[model samples]
Target: MSLCQPRPAESGYGSETSLRRHGSMLSLTSAASALSSTSTSSFKKGHRLREKLAEMETFRDILCRQVDTLQKYFDSCADAVSKDEFQRDRVEDDDDDFPTSARPDGEYNHNNNGSKEKLFSPASPKGINGIDFKGEAITFKATTAGILSTLSHCIELMVKREDSWQKRLDKELEKRRKVEDAYKSAVDELKKKSHYGGPDYEEGPNSLINEEEFFDAVEAALDRQDKIEEQSEKVRKPRLTLASPSDAYSTIGTHRFANKVEETVQNHMAYSIQEVGGDANWYYGDLKLLKVYRREVEENGIVLDPLKATHAVKGVTGHEVCHYFWDTAVRLDWETTIENFHVVEKLSDNAIIVYQTHKRVWPASQRDVLYLSAIRMIPPRNENEPDTWLVCNFSVDHDDAPPTNRCVRAKINVAMICQTLVSPPEGDKEISRDNIMCKINYIANVNPGGWAPASVLRAVAKREYPKFLKRFTSYVQEKTAGKPILF
Candidate 1:
């Protein structure tokens, strides 16, 4: 019966039966203790989980009740409005047929007497949550507006939850960082405690398990929140349709245009230095002293040679010349090769999609183009470099207007970039508009869609390009003669 004290027979030399009985009793007692401990721990864990779930359910139920109450109020208000409007209309209809002269002066409209009194009665049926919306004529529009306003409040709550999504992520990251610090500290403490006893001897039972479960729950919640936000973003993307050239190019931002300008300028500069006049096939124009270059490509036995023309004009800055070229109003005065030209769409202040018809060049048929033209002002790379201006015109496709039956659509892709290398002031002379000399570089590469003989195309480029440049600069000079210089 004395559990803690040793048995007298166990201390002395005992019989086999006594020893076996003592061992069996001790084993049974140990098993019972372990089972009781396990059952108590399981019960506590189940109770904690129930508490957490109940708390979440309570919050959800409160939100649902509020929404239900609001819906009931909206329905009651809508019904009240409809009833009032019907009664008012009936009274008005009955009044219309009654003779005006037959009625006595200061007489009440007896037809609507009972209806009007009932309509404005103070006592009415209570709406949801005991709110009375009686006698007040809330129209259909007003009732709908009220419902939407209430809905917006609910949506706003959800929005507030996610508006700080970035902050939530940062907080999660911070928690992870702190967890890592704690883990490192724990490991260091474990190392020190190892010398005294085992690591588990310092920390209580189930401490490690609880820490792991907490971190795992945090990670799962974070992942769920991240996916929710990502889906919300995808759902929130704007659906944009391109209705015009303006919309088409607007889909591409300004940064994209600036990049295109830079690329065109670089290509133009590379050609100016290395490729222009390097080949023997280049032909010179005697009339305007212009150099015209051509390169040929044989595709399906048809020669497609893109042409490039370069010329220098005096007494004008590249800014003025480019500005003159961009002026669509004055283009008819100088660009003689164009039979008709009109801007179909304005994409931006500096960009447009134009429909243009080039005049027939002897043997080659008249060609048209739907192209986007954009102009840009490239600032100096540093204080020492002179400012440059660039104009790029490239073919674009449009659904609203297609190639006409009269002229073939020419596939043209060209960027005509003009650079102004402002000459240094002549020894103490100020930099004035008249004295500033700028070198103009004009490059054009056009591919007339159908097979036009290479010889004819090259000849047209040699003659017409020079004439085009001379007339353009001359027009610029005439227009800007007495006007202030624009840079």
Candidate 2:
């Protein structure tokens, strides 16, 4: 057969075998190509991994060198700080012998040698403790200096605080010493008085009347007078009018004396409204609505204990409360201790001079008082504040009422301050007693000219003050129930 001619047709089995062989050969070639490609890709991946591991090793060596350098630097810094502290402590311990004084500009001078030194020293070329200093060590020295400066300032502040507290402690100690001395003197006087068998040696009609006997007699007289007045009410006529201010017999030294009284009254008002020390300083009443406080005060070397009482009463106005307190006509009616009371002079419509004698308390002489009573309406300090009423009674010297031996003349600085609070009525309704409340601050500073047992006076004050406030408020409520609103 010619080479260019078509091949002869083979048998069917031969042709099938040839086709299977050809198919097997093609499958082998494709699989070989796939294998070669996979090997090349894996080789490249392994090379890249090796390169990354080499880079990691180099970075670790660099980190190790840096850590080593930092550790050495910190170790050196710790050594330097220890040496500096040791040197500073040594210098301080020897300060007494060396005698250094700090200058105003924060430098120190040796008093012994007249040489100056800086408070904070600069870093030197030759480092501290025989070690040489470089760049970072110089920075460390500067930081150490700043820390030391702050510590010095803190020490100075502590010294100043200690001095201030010492002064306050000294003042408190002085006050306590004075109080102790006064108490000792009082005790000695009381002992002598007790040894002399008490103050019953005096001969007078008032001296014979003890507290109980005097009260019994006064009550009987008051009851008889009340009955007589009730029977004579229809036929009684108003008494003659007293001398007018224009026809005054003797004015009450109004220019200077009035000013003094006004000042005393203002002081009393301020003290009455001030807050007491604490619950321990107050003696509470049975009703728990009244608070009473007392403290011994020394004036002109004579000890005087003053009593202060505070209470809030319902169903009353401040004006009514203050009016009843300032009025002399009703003084004996409510003041059960006063045996008799009369007005000596009327300075003005709101001011009067009165003299009153109190019932004798056993073992104590009869007491009387001459005082100027003045009342004023204080306007509200602010728009939101309610009106205030103040009645002040302070002792005064008058020519008509001179001191007598039968009764010891007492000094009184008393003030009654009241504030009215009105709760608004619903829907423009007029305010009534139900909406009114009165706050009362009563202060009584009584100084008996003669000596009386401090314990007796304090006991009487503690027992009688709460009763007086309660009764006084109740009387005002009853008297003003039918009267028009005073506001």
Candidate 3:
């Protein structure tokens, strides 16, 4: 009985030790189970994050492509605007036929003989390149505005989409960061508790994503988008403004008037000085010295008998001759044929609009003329050549001098060009009228509105032109004999 009592204490001690070991094993098992669950969850979360990143990448690519397309469209719109500006400039440059103020009040069409014939009142809008300029301009402006508006809308939509995408990316990044932190903690716990030193205890290469690289890519995309938006803004705002039709027309009309005057002056200066007509149409003149030629020209169903006369006179300066020819004050003094002469308008210091009634030729109606008379000093083409003076007269319509029924309206285009040659007294001496010689080239294209017998017209021209030149030269010499020379 004493031996059995000693065994009971030993059995109790062993039972207690076994209970403690079991408790420790259970604790280790629970920890292992929790680690496994955490790893699985982390893996799933990582997969979801990868998928989200892939979707973001795809969306970024699409957005980038869309931006490129929009950029190309904007470039095309800019090109179109540039082309429209060029076309506008070309149209303005081509407006050289006549100014609106100077345009004849009739439509002109080319006749079979290539002369312009009046058809109807010329008040209708003209076309350029078969397109109405006013309508084209309006359409161009509307189209440009539409293009700009569409671009602005597209840009706004793109920006909104980008902002939405960015917000989603930010949320996904936050969730991924939390998941990564939990996974890292789980891995550390597993490593600390692991008994068998295995590769699974360390962080795996594919477990953690490179967040820095992804963030950089997103930042780059956003930067590019911002740049695109800036460019779009620049394109939307244009520096050059389109002018209204009225302003454009007014500017073009002024240029046209100036251009016409310059062109006419150049044409008159370039006309051949030698006799133009053949022997039959030569009229009476000495070809060697004083050459006078006459020719008949038809224009707009009207006859124009143009006369060309070239002569050289001693004891007269070119300035004196041109001055007397151009001055309205002295016009009637030498122009014996002019009955009533008055200035309709003074265009400038060197230009005036004159209304003149010429003495009626026998068997012909009295002719009244309204014309613009201008005087200019032409610089010599070469330094060695002397300066030339010119007086030009062309028919022009004036509001103040409307065509009257008192006399037949005559159209005349006349030019008297003269050059002076001075012979200096062997040394440097003041030049006198005797030393100066004026070379004159006169062209007169007269259109008598009313019909007269051809024979009478020719005979009258033959007698009148010579007499006019002689009287004009003589009067100029008499007037400028003691006057200061004008160069």
Candidate 4:
């Protein structure tokens, strides 16, 4: 009895039933073919195939019922055969156990007759046909169990497959519903358009309506619009100025200045350390940096020695404060020293060459400088580690963009590092907002070119550095008052 076998057709008036069965078989075949061949790329096609498969559920049920009926009959036959074989073995054992003897003068031994044996007797031979009967029964039961297990497994697989298909069908139906809604909306828009005189309709002159003249005028207007756009595309544009990453940093003395700039920024962002130079003489508020100002002459005519400054402000994260200074487009709005600044060479998204002319101070000539600027963020190593932020600036030369004769070229080296430090309150100390504080470390060494008095230069350095830090933090607080902290 094969589960997959097709039923034989019956004769006479059973032809209708046989035909119905044939039709169901054909439907099953079609459903199987659809399941195999249906493309899943389109939800509509998949949905249609699923509907077709659903229609064959009744046929599947019919086939399952027929298989169940056949299995029951097979089990009943095996049981009856086992019982009959056991009874025959018992009758034969009785005759063998109590054989006819010469007891009581030629009297027949009634117990030895086959009809006198009990159902189960301890006198019978223990090994007499017992092994054969037990083996037969065990074999029959195992075969039956294997068949049922296979059928049950097949049914479970079919059920699981149907469940998966049903889920997919539901999703497809939802998508189709959304599409239909969008189509209806577009149809409504078309109906509104039709209710009016339509896009092409227009009034003519002299109280007379002329559709031909109206259409011609509309075509002429559209042609004029196209010509204007075409002319705009023909205008010449300036080329983009970009710097090479290799030439962005300076190699002077024993140091690769570019690598040092990036390393200093990244290291400070990850952890805090002792100040590099002597303690800052606070010029204003809590803003200060190590400053060395003397009348010194180095290469390229240096009037004043290099200057460096560091400052830390409470509230706002390092990222927020650094972004404000890094943006060149908005620097002119707040910076007082900048006269004109523009990016000359763009090497990467976060790196570029910038040209800027500072406003002249007193009798000293105006100054201009070109530099490569880049920004980067170091991610935290662990959950407890805070994120670090860095902005690097190192002066570079651009032959094509030489300083104007009125402005002296200056050498500038700067690195801005920000570290986000969230400290919990100690004891009963009240906190302001988010327990957030940003430590800003600014390092700058700027040598103003040309001749200038030491007193004048030192005064400018002391005055400018403090003001720069204050204005920057103020800008950050104002901009990020109600905004979310990025970190």
Tens digits of per-residue lDDT, candidate 1, 1-487, equal 1223221111222335434544543443344344334334444454343443343344344445444655675665566557779989987887787754435676654456677567644433344224212211222223333334334444554565577787899999999999999999997555433423332322223223233333333344335544654565455532222112222322323643456545655676566434454566655444454566666655663445666666666566777777667757666555655778889887667777899887543223457998877766666679887776767787778876698866778766675556565666779986666566656666666666664444544544555566566657766676666555555
Q: Candidate 1: worst 10 consecutive residues by lDDT?
A: 1-10
Q: Residue 15 deviation, candidate 3, in Å? A: 99
Better structure of 2 and 3 per TM-score:
2
Q: Please report, in order, the local distance difference test score of every candidate based on alpha carbons.
A: 0.56, 0.62, 0.59, 0.55
- What are the TM-scores, per candidate, against the unseen true structure? 0.44, 0.49, 0.45, 0.41
Error of 3 at 387 (Å): 0.4
Clashing pairs in 1: none
Best by TM-score: 2
Q: Model 3, 108-172: lDDT tens per residue?
A: 53222211111111211111112222332333343344334334444555676799899999999
Question: Residue 62 of model 4: what lDDT?
Answer: 43
Report the lDDT tens digits of candidate 4 across residue range 1-487: 3334432211222245434544554554454334323322223333443443443343354446545544654454455345547877776777677766666788865553343233223233222212222333333343344344334444555777899999999999999999999999987555433423432222212312243433333344435544653564356232222222322222211223446556656555443333443434423334243332222334543444444445556678877666666767556545656778888877655667899987643334568999877766666689986776667787887876787776778887777777788777788876544678787777666777665444445555665666667767766776666666645
lDDT for model 3, please. Answer: 0.59
lDDT (C-alpha) at residue 370 in model 1: 88
RMSD of each: 40.6, 36.2, 52.2, 30.4
User: Which candidate comes out best when scored by lDDT?
Assistant: 2
